[model samples]
Target: MTHTPQKPIGSGFGPASTADEVIRGISLTGKTVVVTGGASGIGIETVRAFRSAGARVIVPARDTAKAKAALATMPDVIVEVMDLPEPTAIDRFASRVLSLTDKLDVLVNNAGVMAEPLTRDARGYEMQFAANHLGHFQLTCRLWPALVRAEGARVVALSSYGHRRAGIDFRDPHFERREYDRWVAYGRAKTANALFAVALDSIGRQWNVRAFAVHPGGIATPLACHMLPSEIEASQIFDAEGKPVIDPENNKKTPEQGAATSVWCATSPQLAGMGGVYCADCDIAIALPSDGSAEMHGVRPHAIDPISAGRLWQLSEQLTDATLD
Candidate 1:
């Protein structure tokens, strides 16, 4: 299939559509979904909407207490401790999740660290890349059985506009020999997120398992904790009104709006047969320009290229020692 721009098909959804609005009539009774970083921000909103739609949502969190406190009022939501930075912890967490359920309808790889300083995980990989990409990579691989069992399982990888910074540095993903730049590291990780969907959809479609990469748009959330105040100020994300300017030109979106596309990709009947596509503003993205600037609509070709996807997949396997079993 050629990579063409996918229009809305008159789904009647827009950038302002809320998570609840996306699932207005979709009943998810008996559906099982696992959302990483579901304790706060857009993830929490996603959980609330899914649970409201009758799905049993499980949150794999690094801190169960924080997650439980945040989700105290929600029903059918369970919080389990699972640290993504620790590879061994991820293995155990996946095992526990498999033991609890035989089918997984959705897997939202929502948790991620932004442009943090140079640091390494327990496995000595870059912190941002490891936590955001490698962790989810292993989790999905380990849970492949359940996903296949569910039939038509959708895996949503939360990519970002930050992918414009750089594509995956396959030569040295760990940055062992190169100088570390936080934004570039984040860019690489987000790009990996998109390519992951492409590669996964290529392999998973036979089982009716589709994958999507989402640019959640720009949102003002705790995800900015790692950035300096000067950086935030220079970005001009805030206005004189002390609110984020919602100029589509800059691609800023509220958390509710940011979470909308993900929910749409997860439940929209419009995308029943589509997979391996990048989505933004509740619609399929077109091919992005090559300047690596965030001044356009659509995914970058390099980010979704099948060749790059395969290479990144192999690199991820080596870094995390995970196989799609």
Candidate 2:
């Protein structure tokens, strides 16, 4: 939280590491996990990986029909209707989940919107902030009892390199007075995600409920819906012939690979006593500066700042009307 870097531990895994590989020989038997956005992309792979290791997973989706259809074959995975940005539905969903389980081993706040056009929830809050940060914040707070009951629960927030795009503004967070830039909004939301984890860990570590933030790396997915074709081309994620290339030097990952960090954070014995850290490639990452170069990678100071994290926790509670404290 103070920008003290966490050295990489040589996890025997790297960006290309798959979820199965990360969890190989490990058992999640009898563990209970909830993964938002588990119906598709890396979330789907995350659900699959955890289930393969014998964990029971609950997937909350905005579209229950699509979720059910996508997850229909997985008898062990439960698909529930949950649109994160909506406060009332989130509350109802939390109530239902509590009624079903007394404890939770893992919570993956992985659902998020990328660079969409300006949009707000029913509360007139910005969509990315509300959904990516506040929704998970409220859900985690509401589920506090079960998390504590687990005695060693872990919460994973899906942050990103987008965090480097912008830190929390404190004021004008919703773009009410300022003009909106989708990337900046998204980056701030992601920064909030990481900060949320840092703050949660500081509060919950005493109860054995730790938190972590993960950068899943750049993967081609439907999450790219908002990216313009020219922007994508300029980014060089795809070659001129439309073939996908990961720029091996930069370490782009497959969905399974992207999911490895979340699973690792959730179940790795190596990380037993560590919490409130940002992770990537199945290991805790070092905090790096904003060089404004595409080749650079690491958590930013603001994203993991303790002061901002604490303030955000307070703000999140105020916004969502939910908190364990």
Candidate 3:
């Protein structure tokens, strides 16, 4: 097939696509998968889709008890304690993964905190950037060997359309010298997620490992924990009655719909050799202006630029005291 990474390859699924629908006929009986935040909302849905397809899914959550309870009935699933913002925790988890398995077929970096009040991690990094980007960065690096061992591993990073707000602010990433805005911080972190995939695929493709960034649509889930009612109202995602409306024109997505892209990217045969692209609605996104308009549906240049991706990877290496091989 011809390779046009910027354009959708006519994936049969669309806005209304569900995880089960997209994954139909695909069987993963022996594959090992790991999903961060695989307990609730679309994360749970994604876990279910993969497990139903016969994949062994290992979910690492900060609240192990909560994850266990939420995922109690799911088969072929395991929940472990892992706080992404804590580098120590990520290191320990990655070590444990190595001790248990020699290879990882798929890794979904799905756990993330959205717009929230200003908070910092132990290293003084802003919470959103620390947990969403740096933590995944460090974890991917630590797990690079196992991914390589798989020979065809797929790593999916959950980005967002909010990436249009800003790219990485290399100097003040932690809100040290500048004022903080929740949306701007969240945007930067999401952009980092997309760029990380670009750089990772550029580097890892030689080993037959592909990476993708996923923009799960605007779903009303726990991801909105930090946004106030007024903020959500301003976003206009809900009806006057305060119930979610599944309007494609408005970017609304049910949790199962939200999970379609992640699972699709992880296992679809059509994307066998493609990577480093932003995906939404189960298709590769085109480039668009960063004008904050919903009509600008494709990715922005800044989010997929090789130079930007490479620079962020180097900076992430410095911040986490980790290196990319």
Q: Estimate each model's TM-score.
A: 0.95, 0.95, 0.96
Candidate 2 vs candidate 3: the TM-score winner is 3
Taking the tens digit of each residue's C-alpha lDDT, what string does model 3 give over 26-113? 9988888999989988999999999999998999999888899999898458887899999999999998887878999999999999
Counted clashes in each candidate structure: 1, 0, 0
- CA deviation > 4 Å runs, candidate 2: 1-5, 247-249, 289-295
Off by over 4 Å in 1: 1-10, 241-250, 289-294
Residue lDDT tens for model 1, 1-325: 3332433455677767778889899988999999998888888888988898999899999889888999999845988889888888888888888988999999999999999999998778999999999999999999999999998899999998778788998889989989999999999999999999999988898888999999887777889889898998887778977787675445777777778888888888888878888888788876765646466566777788899999998988988889887
TM-score, predicted candidate 1 vs. hidden true structure: 0.95
Against the true structure, candidate 3 reaches a TM-score of 0.96
lDDT of 2 by residue, 1-325 (tens): 2332456877888878889999999888988899999998899999999999999898888898888888877876987788898877887888878888899899999999999899998999999999999999998888889899999999999999789899998888899999999999999999999999899999888888889999998878889899999889877778678876765337567788889999999889888878898998888987775435453577878888899999898888888889894
Sort the predicted structures by lDDT, highest score first.
3, 2, 1
213: Cα error in model 3, Å = 0.6
lDDT against true structure, model 3: 0.90
Q: Return the clash pairs for model 1, or none.
A: 286-298
CA lDDT scores, all candidates in order:
0.86, 0.87, 0.90
Candidate 1 or 3, higher lDDT?
3
What are the runs in model 3 whose C-alpha is more than 4 Å off?
1-4, 289-294
